[model samples]
Target: MRFPGFTGEWKETTAAETCSEFKSGKGLKAENILSEGLYPVYGGNGLRGYTSTFNHDGFFVLIGRQGALCGNINIAEGKSYITEHAIAVQANTENVTGFFQYLLLNMNLGQYSDQSAQPGLAVNKLLKLRINLPSKEEQQKIATMLSLLDARIATQNNIITTVC
Candidate 1:
């Protein structure tokens, strides 16, 4: 469960312990999203559109709170506005990297989602979900590796688009 060169067992902790804040986003309607706005507006499925104002600043992990994609994870950096369909996980960078936390969340959140008429992720239940925290260095290493892979994937996708 850890990368090479890293020793010691990872510590068990709840999501709430690592995250400094967890709250559902403020209500933002589809009509409010502007195409030529200053800030990106995030919903359950990621960037829905743009807006003129923002409610959150800095880096945070956004988890989809409802719908079939409940438990989906996305990262919001700098100034952005999150809507009611997602919950933000704001972790202190000193302890955990936002990207690493996002990967961990996406890997384990599916089981916590309620599969009722409308699929949903309850914040209280999500906060209690267990997580294994690795050393900061290990986290950085893993995140860097994943980010590099993501960049490669994006490049391939762009090349495919251009060829088509």
Candidate 2:
């Protein structure tokens, strides 16, 4: 991000400045998934596969690393796996909010995008990304505000569909 109105410039930061670690998910074969269960399986993109086993149980951002849906970030539920080629960033409570970190990632991803015709995200490049952040309180408020907007949009869409 660049400074607006002033000649001063925004700073560049390493990914470590904002979090504790960037960890990848577990490897599970698809045949293991029970027909219906309580675990989430994430692959190069969103929930590409399924499983009955879980690796982590908490709020975290799953950053897709190398595939068709690479740059996209998905929020995981109580229990899940990251899979190969995807890195999960578990927020470091003191510096970043879990939802807010996901928002920031969703907001600004172009810089790390390979910009290929296929447009795949780079793990090495993503892990080094430094984001300009707002204060924790501000981040919380933004998350709340956006969440409201999302809820309202969902309601509105439901109303429209009902009418249709």
Candidate 3:
């Protein structure tokens, strides 16, 4: 669906074209994980635990790369450690990070996983996949709206958790 005042068709591009970096996270052993630490560690299933060291900082989208949950995506921000189980993606100057997060979330990447005992998403295959993109202004508008909605949902979930 097109938003009001947005004209022209979205440009078609591959993930590799829009992203500056698409690579796997560094390895972090299970022993390194701590119940409470300075940084959060992200794995295939997300938020595996916390750790003393971090491999990533700033905002980026993480895609699960192995196991049954392969192809799952999550947004990571600030000082954090993205384990080898997740592929980190950073949008280029032309695109908004939040916009890509929403786009990847809707993509249902699980379908692209390799059919093995433990499904896995290959970084190269994901990079080659085609995606549509609107103008920077339009991307910002859409991402802001969706992020606000996500915040509201989180708030509601917190309230439910507290009440119930």
Candidate 4:
């Protein structure tokens, strides 16, 4: 399946090629997570809480790197702290981060997690995984479309919450 007016085959590439960085975040103890603060804290499963400090600024794609939720993905932007349980990904300038987020969501990376006392995803493993890539222009279009749909969904949820 593909969008209209966009034609051409997507190139096959490795995750490593599409991304410039796949490093784990610094460890922030559970007690450090505050109810509310200046920066949002991101962990394996997503936003854990907030804290006074931030380790990363700007946009990033975070992958849950450990525990039952290994391989789960989340998007973070602005001032945010990514904990040790999440690997912060920086997509290459040639690719759109939003498009990679949706692509990873569809990939179901959980299946790649290693079975252990606590399942985990290794950065090296993710780097070796195969992926398909389209032109930068096409990627932007796809990301824009998905982002709009997501906004609509969020709005609908708010409406439902208000009514019910």
- Kindly report which residue pairs in candidate 4 clash with one another: none
Candidate 4 ranges beyond 4 A from true positions: none
Candidate 3 lDDT tens digits, 11-130: 999999999878999998899999899999998878988999989888989999999989888978999999889999988999998899999999999999999898999999999999
What lDDT does model 2 reach?
0.66
Give per-residue CA lDDT, model 2, range 14-95, as digits (tens): 6666666566776777776545666767775777656767887777777777655566677777887667656777667755
Model 4: how far residue 136 lies from native, Å: 0.7
Q: Which candidate leads the pack in lDDT?
A: 3
TM-score of 3: 0.94
TM-score of each: 0.89, 0.75, 0.94, 0.94
The TM-score leader among the candidates is 3
Write one digit per residue (lDDT tens) for candidate 4, span 65-87: 99987888898999999998999
Q: Rank the candidates by lDDT, best first.
A: 3, 4, 1, 2
Clashing pairs in 1: none
TM-score for predicted model 2 compared with the true structure: 0.75
Off by over 4 Å in 3: none
The models' CA-based lDDT, in order, is 0.81, 0.66, 0.92, 0.90
Count residue pairs with overlapping backbones in model 2: 0
Estimate the TM-score for candidate 1.
Answer: 0.89
Please, what are the lDDT tens digits per residue for candidate 1 over residues 13-74? 87778777787999987788988789999988899889999999988788889988888788
Stretches of candidate 2 off by over 4 Å are 1-12, 99-102, 105-120
